[model samples]
Target: MELNNKKVKELLPQKEPFRFVDYVDDVDKNNKTIQCNYTFKSDNPIFLGHFPQEPIVPGVLLIEAMAQSAILLMLCIGNEISLDGEKYLLSKVEEVRFNKPLFPNQKANIISKIERSIPHFYFFSSKVYNGFEDKILEGKFIVFKK
Candidate 1:
């Protein structure tokens, strides 16, 4: 199923200026995968200090966007997690590689899939790609339920 901005806002724990996901392009409950899109605006506050002369979306923010996308997918499809009460923490970021630089006003797609799940932690493999299909970043992250 596809989730629009409003549904995404209501489902995701993050608020504006912090929520990175713009739309859920696709979701596969059976495979535990999700494809999401995000656009970095020129006016984003981070660009002010990151490099005003040549503002680019930071690598850290890209990771955050990927993580947010993964969590949103799980929350939307996982029957075990309650939409209102469950809290999740990003416990680990692993093997992150930033291959391309993303600039302001650019759009990227986050493709994420659950790789493993332990007692309290969910592991996800994710990739961020620009419109031209250049890989922006790829990594695995573990999110712990609290």
Candidate 2:
């Protein structure tokens, strides 16, 4: 189904600007995959501290955004599961690769797909890329709702 920008922001935990994801482009409830995007604005608070003369999106926040995307998708597809019963969290990240640097006001695209799922564990991989589809971040991640 198609998800708008506003709905995506609400699904994520962070507030604006600090909320790295901008929109949920699509999610296949059956396939267990989702696509999202984030536009780095100049006014983002992280920019002020991440760099001074030249600003860059901190790698750690980038990972957080990616993880958020994965959780959002799981929530969408795993409709039978209740989020409040336990907690949907990103439990692991492996083989993470950052291919490019993200500066202010750049568009970051994220694509996440669920690789496996059990009653308690959700495994997924997400890739963050620039507008041109050049990879900025890629990793295999999982979350345990417990």
Best-performing candidate as measured by lDDT:
1
- For candidate 2, the 10 contiguous residues with the lowest summed lDDT are 78-87
State the lDDT of candidate 1 residue by residue for 1-146, as single tens digits: 89899888888888888899999999999899999999999888899998989898989888889889888888868774346787878899999998989988879899999998989889999999998889999999999877
Give one digit per residue, the lDDT tens place, for model 2 in 9-80: 666655665676778888887788898888888887777888978999888888888887887787777654
Clashes of each: 0, 0
Candidate 1: segments with Cα more than 4 A from true spot: 80-82
Residue 121, candidate 1: Cα error in Å is 0.6
TM-score of each: 0.95, 0.87
